[model samples]
Target: MPPVSSPGLLDGTGALRTSVEERAARVRFRRAMALMVMTLLAPGSAQLVAGNRRVGLVAFCLWLGLLVTGFVALVVALVVALVHREWIFSMVSNPSLLLVLRLGLIAAAVGWAALFMDAWRIGQPLSLRLTHRRAVVGVNGFLCLSVMGTLLFGAHVVGVARDGILTMFGSDEVVGAHDGRFNVLLLGGDSGEGRWGLRPDSLTVASIDAETGRTVLIGLPRNMSSFPFRDGSPMAEEFPDGFDCDGCYLNGVSTWAQDHEELFPGSEDPGVEATIAAVEGITDLEINYWAMVNLEGFKDLVDAVGGVTLNVRQPIPVGLPHEAHFHYIDAGVRKLDGHDTLWYARAREGSDDYSRMARQKCVMNAMLQQVSPQVVVRNFEKIAQASTAMVSTNLPASELDTFMDLALKARGQKVSTLSLVPPMIQTADPDIPLVHRKVEQAIEQAEGGGTKAAGGTGRKPKATPDAVTGGSIGSLSEGYAANQAEDLGAAC
Candidate 1:
């Protein structure tokens, strides 16, 4: 045979190199398959001492299916590249599938980690069984906790398929304003009509500072009278259907038609503009959005959140003779369901809405407290279920994400609750002081704005325009009866 030429040497070496690469690939593939099989069959690091083989097998099979799919796709891509001589194209396409590939790899890693952790405990000496059992329990508990954390965090963003009252608002358009402050008008209506859809039961103005993540909820009494709907309508317009008003205050919305039968017949008409104007006047804050959740809606939210905890200083019994008799709570810490929560908030006779406000705050605080990692995880499905039906907000879907993100960050932050009752207003002029500039100033300061310092302690009072007072604070010069009249007028 002729001595090998240099060209021949190069060609032979290239073939050898290719063969080596193929063999190496085969070895790697076999090793991976073997490793997977061993993981499935062997206890590895898991405690075979307490193995539920069926569950383990199922989990393993699912994990294997994912891994196999990833590997097959990778192999197919490689084969196509080799056959078409399009290595560059294949390389480019492979990275596009990185998320799926990475996810598969991550699942594999977690499975192995779990197995190893279990194994470590299992491999311990027999003397360590008690301690090891405890450790295993802890590990399992942690796994459950991890699952729940993921669910709760995702719940706020996810909505169910059910047709929840499809209330729409403006598409979210972010106009960045420094110290972005938003005033939300919360309307609470007392609709005497039983089971008649939704109506606001407690009105609260939530002033949220986007920049500082501080919020204040200011309660407005439903019976407050002077807030004429800005549309120039009579207060009795809401009662036009000739509803019995022996004791029940006419729904605020009824005031627009002046109780004229010709205008709004057979049903109470909501005085939206007047309600808006009244809220705006009281807070001296522009109303950016409004949401109305009736008593049932309130109950639904509480129940959905798995009931809220409230510290009850006294027992509260609500509902007249015919309605569902419910107890607000007993003294001390008690968990209240949605119905009870609404009743608790509506227990004006028990504490006259002032104490009711306190209960509202208590219930809110309790709700927040119950949102543990575990609860969130277990009720992930329910949490999503409740938000869709029980709540309505002017916040568009797009804005929801940003708002949720901000809310999460501020979750653990200190929230101060205040109700402007009795001494804060006047024994006589609860309504007068409410719309008064003094009240507005106090609110603004509490919300960390205007001339008042954040949390507004010891701040010099900004002189409220006398023109706005309108002799409402019971004429500072007049004694008790005049003060009482002023108070009554203001409260009305």
Candidate 2:
């Protein structure tokens, strides 16, 4: 009508309009994607730019407060670590602080997830084209899941750590170091069926320097007899002269205490108390705490740490000599599994108790040196489970941090060993005064940065023509090198 308008022209104009709409939709899609990314980087940033200023201000302020607090805390922690490291350890070891941290992490995770959802709302996804809306939904969903999943996982790990701390270290009674050292009684308890109550098959005193963390492992054979008890203790009152009776030995102290439970009135574990008394009497070193390791469960702990490496000088039998289904661990410098390692430490076939004792020391030293912090962190859950079943201790929970610090220090230093075996002192009838003297000297040497001669405290026994016996390098008569070595690593 007005100059006869062409249908082609009208169609071209409509196509141009359609193109403009498509461009707008593309812009909306990119805006939505940007909002989600902003939230990922900074939780409330999208709302501040696009919508809900009040809510955005509150969330942003809270986020900023948290960031500032975390940064300040980190700075303080670094300073404390340099100046007063124990303070940091004490804070971490506190059950109350751990619980608070667990709850705070959970709260942070929830709050952050909510902020991600809010950011998606601020992006105005509903106003975009159908394809753009779907894309925005996918991106927002991914951001929420990834961020929330990471936070939730962190919270779970913290929870596990808190539970483990509570389960393993429940004691509240704290004991101080004695004579510039902390002497801990390490008892190897055998409590399987057909065995007399929970008797200690292996006994050792870990005398650690309070400041330096230099340690001396004092091995007391389970077969030791005629040892006195701590003065004024229940066992001491019963046997004033000494624990000298028919069929009596150091390991039997626990069984004897259990038989006469009334002797230890109000005591939760009479066996441990009696054993502590015996250790104190024998070594003349005050006992700060005791840890009883379940020998059967010990294998589980070894497995948890992914086994241990050892120098097996000879074939070690897997089971009792008389057992029909027994095997031997071949001699080599090998990484052995839990089953073989347990047998390696406990085997008695063709080996005397002294040789077995030496093997145990080697195992102890290897574990101390090889099981680093990274190994513990990687296998944390498995180790926590195994430790609960394997060990029972009377050490206070508060002292855990102190010992952890000391353990780290001890790893770099050589471990000295003093065993009351063969040439040093007869197990059947030990020299109590001489035992005390040897213990004191060992501690003195450890502090003085010197170690006893390779053979041990006293005169060395005549070695047999054969050097290798059992799994150790030295014969039983001459005393295994690991049993009484200045540097346990070198001897093993």
Best by TM-score: 2
Where's the lowest-lDDT run of ten residues in candidate 2? 454-463
Write candidate 1's Cα lDDT for 150-226 as tens digits. Answer: 44434323323112323333325443423376666666544345532233456676656775555555556554443
The weakest ten consecutive residues by lDDT in model 1 span 480-489
Off by over 4 Å in 2: 1-18, 125-134, 191-197, 319-327, 449-466
Model 2 agreement with the true structure over 1-492: per-residue lDDT tens digits: 346444334453354234566777888888888888877787777788997777778878888898999999999999988977778778877888888888888887888788888878777878998888888888888888888888887778777777777877878999998878899999898858755236888999999998979999999999899999999999999999898999999989998998899999999889889999998999999999888888888888899999999988888888866778688888889898788888999998888888899899999999999999899889887887788777788887799889988887899999988898876788888999988878877777777744564433533333444687776767755677877766788878
What lDDT score goes with residue 22 in model 1?
52
467 Cα displacement, candidate 2 (Å): 1.0
Estimate the Cα RMSD of every predicted model relative to the unseen true structure: 18.1, 3.9
- The C-alpha TM-scores of every prediction are 0.50, 0.88
lDDT of each: 0.47, 0.84
Q: Which residues of candidate 1, in runs, are more than 4 Å off?
A: 1-179, 189-199, 228-251, 254-270, 318-328, 372-374, 417-436, 447-492
lDDT of 1 at 280: 55
